[model samples]
Target: MMATADEGVILVVEDDGAVRNLVATALDVHGYRHREAASATAALLDLTSSTDINLVILDLGLPDRDGVEVIEALRGWSRMPVIVLSARQEDADKVAALDAGADDYLTKPFSVEELLARVRVALRRLAYDSPATPTEAAIYRNGELLIDFGAGVATRGGEELHLTPIEYKLLALLARNTGKVLTHNYILKEVWGEAVASDLPSLRVFMATLRKKIEPDPANPRYLQTHVGIGYRMLRVEEAARL
Candidate 1:
């Protein structure tokens, strides 16, 4: 098998042997090292044991447990990229999988080209950016939105925007960790402190308010992307690397 250090590992979790083999073949063709898990239990065990597995391609109908359960369980500890592959075509099913912490979803009968594209996008997010070091620039910008870490300010379209303390902290956290999904618990602990880390409702409300101010369309945000059940991701630097 052809492999490079940068072609990160993927875990294919599907109950069907044929689907698993197909996905594994695609991964191999694309130069991604992969492992196959026929059940959620096996997938979780692989996740716990393999430090190098960078992504998961999960199916919703596992023999032992639902794939959403797998996503939920995985999000409890790791934010590895999880792109759900399922035959369930309902909007509710997609939403459930995404909200359960799956990063992206693909319905059955998907094209290999589209699947590869999604894989690239997800892996690029994981590989292209590292956490901000102390020496890194304090200001982060994506077109209209700008976060100034030094001044502790967030602005849109070159205008100063008013934000509550918690809102500012949340924005700062997202800005600092752009491209990476921040789970609700992690965000709460960082912004609200560990004392109130379990307050999910408060986080949701604040996120909504922050979106309204920074996003041109709060209904459809550009800068803040929600990982549904997982958390949120600020636009990755690679998406705007040319700027």
Candidate 2:
């Protein structure tokens, strides 16, 4: 998914030799180049040292150290896309990983197709993993508040935001449309996929967080205006001269 005309690398960190090779081979068949690390320490080393690694498939069970530690440890500075692999299929487990900055999670005995799809979702979440031109990428700016579409960075009142993956995705979607009347379904499709379009509760929570970050007042939203049954919009602020 590198913008440049070269192969991008995906790092697979799994303790199981068979699983590691299986996942790596699947990626290879899908035309993605990759490297593998068997232990958490080596994974950290690969993550820290490489500028080539675009994404990671991380196993939560490691030989040398705890897998959650690897995530907590990597999240200290890196924002690279991380898709956690876990044998536990509990909702709490998935939530925990997501809350800790993992992009997505896959339970064991997963299909290769699903694995590739999750990787695609992670790449999409990263907001500039494709070969799109910088100019074509969507962005929004109003004085001190700025949203860079290609960079996946949001700033408000002149300070950068440390947004989660879902938050960033929602921001990009709204920022792209700006004044347009984007429906709730539209927003869901753009951010969480069509499958979760009816999951308004989840979307509402994300929207509320987005308002708190970008709006002058979350209760009385200024930048992000809600249209009730409709979706939200990032209002285009007019210059003082216009008034």
Candidate 3:
């Protein structure tokens, strides 16, 4: 079944009582059903006990275990969307959480509105990516950018884009995982095959070229967003517009 925007339960895991309450209250105000857990153990227990948890807002500084461990454990069996809401603002911390399978990362003292927006985006992506949702067309569209996977081509503003083989592969990879941040290592393995070593410099060159083809203004990219030391994300049209 195609879940509605706010149809599923969201679990908020935070060791701080004030922050937990704040997040939970915001969710409640926004008409989202949510559960709270103060530790990784409790969070994992709730996830295992209930089949209704479709998303998680986790704090990395958990009392029992770090949130990345929780993400790793969850990834062992589930592909559920996890948004890390932590005080850790380091680029390495963000990269670690993302590489561990977190869907998004938000620093501490975050905006409640931004948090809700991320939640909405995650749920929508879940619905779109669902096996039961009937995405047989296999086409990806965000604003002027359209990737016709069936035809093995991409177009912008009604014109076909002339992309090299490597550029095309990179575009296809990001389009397939739209709205999610993909790590450099993940992209390298997918595009260049598993045997390829960490070639971030090459990836950056390819991505820069790919952006020039799709983005109207490559200097300020509207489609592809860079997470600096982390990786990249394909923003949906609406999200890109706000950027």
Candidate 4:
């Protein structure tokens, strides 16, 4: 079945009434069903009590608790997509939210169009990861890049791109979660296990090398996008084409 904006229920968690209303209005205009929560407690209650909430648009500052805390709490069980919408512009804040398990981050005074675009991406990823869909494929293709997971090889434009073992692991991890942000800590834990979970420097070095192998112009990358202090995301082929 084709996915539509009306297919899932979105939870909008913002303490600021004006901002919350604005976000809710945009979702309503876009034909999306949504629920609103003015505080972290309310948000968490709603999330835990309801199984139909498909995604979340959360603000960092809440009346009762910090948004990152809510994200961490939510991550304790749910893999539901959370997009942090905050006034906190610092890379540190963004990294914190992502590390706490947010799927995406958008700073306050954001463009509605961009927010909706991100919502679409998140929801699409949710659908893609749903059990109804096959979790893994023998091969994954994005434009000229093709990763044959079964064969354990990646190629670009019909040519095999030699990648280090670490690079290959990183590529496969990102590819599997395309369109979702992967924090340094999360990537490290997943790819290298807990022993080197704090090794951000090594992850950066490996990611740099991986980009060079797959990207036609590493200077202007079309596939992998760096989120500065946050982490990295593997853009879907259609999304990368726009970049």
Q: Highest TM-score: which candidate?
A: 2
Kindly give the stretch of ten consecutive residues in candidate 2 with the minimal lDDT sum.
Answer: 1-10
* Cα-based lDDT for every prediction: 0.76, 0.74, 0.80, 0.80
* lDDT tens per residue, model 1, 1-243: 344677678899998998888888888886888889999889899999888899899999999999999999988888777888899977668656655666666779876766776677567656534564576447888777888765667788899976644566678888888889999999977754454556575467567767877888777677888888999999853463432
What lDDT score goes with residue 34 in model 3? Answer: 87
Q: What is the lDDT of residue 153 in candidate 2?
A: 77
Ranking by TM-score: 2, 4, 3, 1
Name the regions of candidate 3 deviating beyond 4 angstroms: 1-6, 132-243
Cα lDDT tens digits, model 4, 1-243, are 223655679999998999999998888887889999999999999999998899999999998999999998988888788888999977667656666767666777878876886677667655444343233447888999999876568999999986544567689899999999999999977755554466575466567667877999999899999999999999987898797
> Could you estimate the TM-score for every candidate?
0.58, 0.64, 0.58, 0.59
Instruction: Candidate 2: list runs displaced more than 4 Å.
Output: 1-5, 121-151, 177-189, 192-243
- Scored against the true structure, residue 53 in model 4 reaches a CA lDDT of 94
The positional error of residue 129 in candidate 2, measured at the CA in angstroms, is 5.9
The sequence of per-residue lDDT tens digits that candidate 2 reaches over residues 178-213 is 778788898777765654456565566566655666
Clashing pairs in 1: 99-229
Cα error, residue 127 of model 2, in Å, equals 7.5
| Candidate 4: worst-modelled 10 consecutive residues by lDDT | 128-137
Candidate 2 to truth, TM: 0.64
lDDT of 4: 0.80
Clashes of 1: 1
lDDT of 3 by residue, 106-197 (tens): 78788887677667766765654444324545778889888876566789988998664456668988988889999999997775544443
Ranking by lDDT: 4, 3, 1, 2
